[model samples]
Target: MGDELRADQFRTEAASPRGFRQVYVREGVGGVPLLLVHGWPETKRIWWRNIAPLAAAGFEVIAPDLRGFGDSDVGPDGFHDVPSHARDLYALVRGHLGHERVVAVGGDLGGPVIQDLSLRFPGFVERMVLFNSPLPYDRERMAGLRTRPPREASDYFVPQGTDADALAAELATPEMRRRYIATFYTSRFWAHPGAFAPEEVDFMTEPFGDGAKLRASFGAYESTFSEAARSEPTAMACPNPTPTLVLFGPSDHVIYPDFDRMAAAVFPEHTGPFRLRDCGHFVQWEAAHALNSAVTAWCGDLLAGRRRQ
Candidate 1:
């Protein structure tokens, strides 16, 4: 399953007007455009296991490294918040690739990004598949969803949000940075235990060895505490109306336990908050076959509709 994506076959880059070049993997052709957005501490490589399977399942799988996370260039202006990430994607998929409609799939930080994309450009994102990602918290509708990530599970958030510069400085060397990022895949228990082998961990953390990219990857966390990097008031208040299919990986230790409930509350037109056992936060990597099956099955009618068009 890990051998699904070949760099030579799908790797490509698109220039963004936002003053940076974005690197991505473009697989399959002449099929429905399915955009795969990756999250923090990861790059487009996170979807390596899912891309080919999804493409073969009859969709064009487009996975890009969010700005500054991998081969993509960081924003010259230094903003890496969810809105900025969403805009970059819009320019790449809609403006550049000429896809006016697409199925957006994401988890982790990528989850909020796809959410923003759907809300900001509803017509463009025709449908969505969200898993193990954060969703808007509605106090009334989500009153029964009280589970939060355990304190030990989230101990890294504060320093990453408030002291990025200091933390970046502390992780001065490439080796140090990779070591730090490796924890998220291994000791951090973000994935189901034993999901990743040593070589797999190396492949996932390699991009973080670049100190600059590693620091820039912290932009999402920094945005949590920085007013300038936060999403706009209107964006935060609006509910996402895109037809969505939500999935949960119960073994995840880093994300909120009640992610399904929150996602159900936020997406007005939504499908299953289906839970996958033995999977964790990194669903694409840990549950590749299941993810592919769910996406292909859920979007069957939409895919058929596109074929008719």
Candidate 2:
């Protein structure tokens, strides 16, 4: 209850370069600097449940709405993409948070952005905590890819990934947009069953109600191939030096099951692909207590030099 009491104690701030005029929250006074990034179809509010535990663990927690989502400014057309998001995030951490090196935590699309930070802006991210996210599958990982029999494809990705115009117009209205975003919260193929209460569903989908926000969010998927390539030259020349803690949810339907396998080799200093039970895509939401515990423990161990990563 103490944590909850201090939950609203976060000091709110904003930065122009991040492309959002939205209010952002920063908590905790002193410790390791931590930046928490949220993924698509959701906002920084998703971090509400973890804020207290994480910030209480002795770290300045900076959580912000990604551009084009939540209360953030939705800029002009075709501007939101993965590489571009990384740029804004860099500014937010260095310019806003005043941290050159930080512990970055992310899930969903946020993971990719953090990954880019580590790759592009090396020495800036000391550690990473990623969950149920897409990781780069290089040669060995791809070769060893054990095709999970019935490769269930998403009817969603390509439409959003490739054809932006048609789908954007289709769900242009707020009501229609919310209706479409609702599917992810309810879809059996996605979230864990009974994962969302009615109010929670509305909260998660609220940001995507705007057409510009909804459309910009899709660019993440679209920029996947091109952006990942930006890091290949670096990856080959220099091994991934960032230590990563990968928390995985077996209940998640979309992400490949054995991604931790790919991640293990990819991130030279890596820990458990800690399999989480009774959770789905939104691991932090469905398993908040467990996620909080794991993150804090890792942070503690990391700071104590017990982990050496």
Candidate 3:
């Protein structure tokens, strides 16, 4: 954790025209901007390990806690679906931050948001670095790929999506909610075993201690089961034209086992689909050095531009 970006020092809040206040970490000064989006059971803290390294490699890193997660507000409308998240980011980057183009990087739920961002607002995302994220199902292209998540690993989905209200009610207390989210970080095998120490787990679960935010975070899952719960940018136009670099951490039991293959099929302009050993769902933390090296190498031209200056 040497030179890690401290959330307390850099976190800032920007009012989104779309109606929520976005809390994000904006680091680095004038290099090519890259947005590092986090997914379910995670906050911007997930990228803390990789942020300083990436900024050092010559890129401005913007990591935001999607609405309803971390310190960010859930907004009056209470929509946390992919499209809604994408729109919030669109407004944050293009509208508030004033960056016309960005290199989008995300995993888990962030995967869909970036995908939707690239599709819904073409030219906004110049490239993408995706890992441990969801890919749109295409029958023909993903013919041989294991596109569906393993059933044993997916027990949390139905409960979270369909019974969000009841589930939230059942969890009841902050400690109960944190315990539930803690499983994804531990026994759930969302990360490679032994990735998180006890203190690290405490840091990650601290934000979930808020009952309201935890409940709002379930909206994304709910959108999948009910159309009525969807936001405007609901469907992502696949075969996303944006050039992408796909990295997979195979140890993750929660997502599609053949994610690398499936991602390659869906993103025609994709590179690598590289698999990192001993890594799992949380690529940034599990394989920090590798993830940092990959991102810097993938965006060499951008880093070089800064060198040329």
Model 1 RMSD in angstroms: 1.8
For 1-309, candidate 1 gives per-residue lDDT tens digits of 345433444667667656788888888877789999999888998888888888887898899889998899987788888988998899988888889899999999999898888888868888999999877777887887855887898999999999999999999898899899999998988899999888888888888999888888888988988887664522533367888899999888889888887788888798988999888899999998899999999888877876888
Rank the models by TM-score, top first: 3, 1, 2
Write down the lDDT of every candidate, Cα atoms only. 0.85, 0.73, 0.88
Off by over 4 Å in 2: 1-11, 18-22, 147-153, 225-239, 301-309
lDDT for model 1 comes to 0.85
What TM-score does prediction 1 earn? 0.95
Residue-by-residue lDDT tens digits, candidate 2, 1-309 = 344323245567777865457457888746677888887667887787877788877777888887777767764434566566677788888876688788888888888778878887879888999887767656754576642412453668778877777999998699899989888778744678887877778777776788877887777766653453232222221246798898877677777767666667677788897887778778878888988888788888555552243
TM-score of each: 0.95, 0.86, 0.96
Stretch of 10 with least lDDT, candidate 1: 230-239
lDDT rank order:
3, 1, 2
Backbone clashes in each candidate structure, one number apiece?
0, 0, 0
